[model samples]
Target: MRKQHIKSHPVASLYVENQSWLRGWLYRKVGCTHLAADLVQDTFERLLKRESYGDVEKSGAYLKTTARNLVIDHWRRKALEAAYMEALHIQGEAYHPSPEEQHMHLDLLNRIDQVVQRLPVQTRQVFLRVQLEGWGYAKVAESLGISVSTVKRHLKAALLECCFYCE
Candidate 1:
């Protein structure tokens, strides 16, 4: 059974009170007013889709966190697209996947990114260094100041999470 939701802070009230501040807040981090405004709209749309803001005691803080996350997501997506384009460039047009395959690959990448983002902070860090940066376990452990065993543990956890989503 779903827990009943009550809108202690109605989304309109929250939007009216927060949009300008949130936009500025996002702009500071993103350095683009248009992008900030777009993120602000997306942020509120997020709240709108929720059953409720529920019992949020500090709505501004919550909004800031949410907005910050959106900015991070925006950057991550940009980086991912750049990398995909770079890979395609390396492969050349003749080797390119069909549009359908390209879309499927992007969707999978997004889903895997979401999984990585959901990982515990330390685990995510370890996973990125090893997988994205091509760092070995020893190198990641040394750089992170953790034991090789600990690095292996984090990688194992990350791989298990990814594999769970795989066929």
Candidate 2:
């Protein structure tokens, strides 16, 4: 088979220009060289998939924003995984899942996490408060300084997003 030459994307230039700076910023935020490198790669990958880079004048700002979101996502996933592991630990040895089942559960959790990350911030917070933390809608609204109806709306949006992910 002949190897095909792949054209470099426009984002390639952006990556070449900003990779080091972005990685350094991420390293300062995350305090891990390896994780920062991974996040830099993810940031560019996300940029490549975006429909438009928006204003060329603000490309650097866009890149930084994307990288910052990636860092937040990394932390959120880490926290979710930690919570999952803690739950499993609390279940004790009596609740052993087969390896395959465990893998499936983790995969499902990752899918759920991806869906949650795509949600609007307020909706995500409302969903997490009501579902994960077992808070009532009223409590979430009170804490978030929103009305109960607004909380319900956010939860509905979040659930719809989850349903879309499952499909």
Candidate 3:
């Protein structure tokens, strides 16, 4: 009966039995209750999705290392996000804009969208290719089977129209 039960049961039960030890191990290493809880949850989540492990004897060791790596990754991502937010905050402080300036920028972007919508099909295609898709003039010209000069002309027309409407 014991053998049959072990065979029928999921490894998830083993994880549940070890959860407290896993949390304690993680907390000791990470020194943060929240971080340890998060890592413990993620470790189990990965275990659930993983395929059959031939050598189940190493589960605990593997889980511990995986939890540590996850903690490292979390710290790295947090640092990157912090740096990005700091940069954005500094830029915001450096370039203070009046409410009118903000409104004007939004208005110009809307008008540019309207102008692009009004353009001829070919002109709109060329503009979207170069500006929105980040394609080079040569690439756009080759793809559309048009001369590079024609590509340039369409781009100029689109820009002029957008600027005229924006102002």
Candidate 4:
């Protein structure tokens, strides 16, 4: 039965049905076959890690949305890597880290990115404006139209998230 097939090999069937078009879509967006292929795999891998991924509707829209997020994540990681390398270059060869340290730093950056990405939208906005942009709590609260106490709450939650992930 068709139901039996899906129950037995849900992801494999989904992949067989959607992989080619999804790869094509990614290639059109990123302009690279290799990167597109890589992102396609990443998207499905992300689905497999979900506890109830099998409950996802057998729909193109869901798959497309997942692939789009992977593309956004890929772009973000690339930008982070470029900025990091630029910072290191500015420090000159005399300040260059050992290769192992450099790898560790980049990996840490990626993990931090993941933690930030997991934050809720308002919490992320508060955390970013305060921490990343150096805005005071009142300033960030005014800009976001949230109360200062709310801003502090969000920052506390964000800090707790970071601490939880650090270990």
Q: Which candidate is the best by lDDT?
A: 4
Candidate 4 runs further than 4 Å off? 1-8, 52-57, 141-151
Tens digit of lDDT per residue, candidate 3, span 1-167? 98777655566565767779989988987889888898999987776677875454346877777788777767655655566456556898777667677556545555566688789998999999999899999999999999999999999999999877776
Clashes of 4: 0
How many residue pairs clash (N, CA or C atoms closer than 3 angstroms) in each of the candidate models, in the order given?
0, 0, 0, 0
lDDT of 4 by residue, 8-114 (tens): 76787788888999999999999999999998998888777877765564787878999999899888989999999999999998799998998898888888788
Ranked candidates, highest lDDT first: 4, 1, 2, 3
TM-score computed on alpha carbons, candidate 3? 0.48
Query: Per-residue lDDT of 1-167 in model 1, one digit per residue for the tens?
Result: 23233344477667777899889989999999999999999988877777756754346887787888899899998888788878999999778998899878877787789899999999999999999999998989989899999999999999999889753
Predictions in order: lDDT: 0.85, 0.85, 0.78, 0.89
TM-score, per-candidate, Cα-based: 0.68, 0.70, 0.48, 0.78
Question: What's every prediction's RMSD, in angstroms?
Answer: 5.2, 4.1, 13.8, 3.8
Query: Candidate 2 has what TM-score?
Result: 0.70
CA shift at 9, candidate 2, in angstroms? Answer: 4.3
Q: Find the 10 residues in a row with the least total lDDT in model 4.
A: 51-60
Give the range where candidate 1 is weakest over 10 consecutive residues by summed lDDT: 1-10
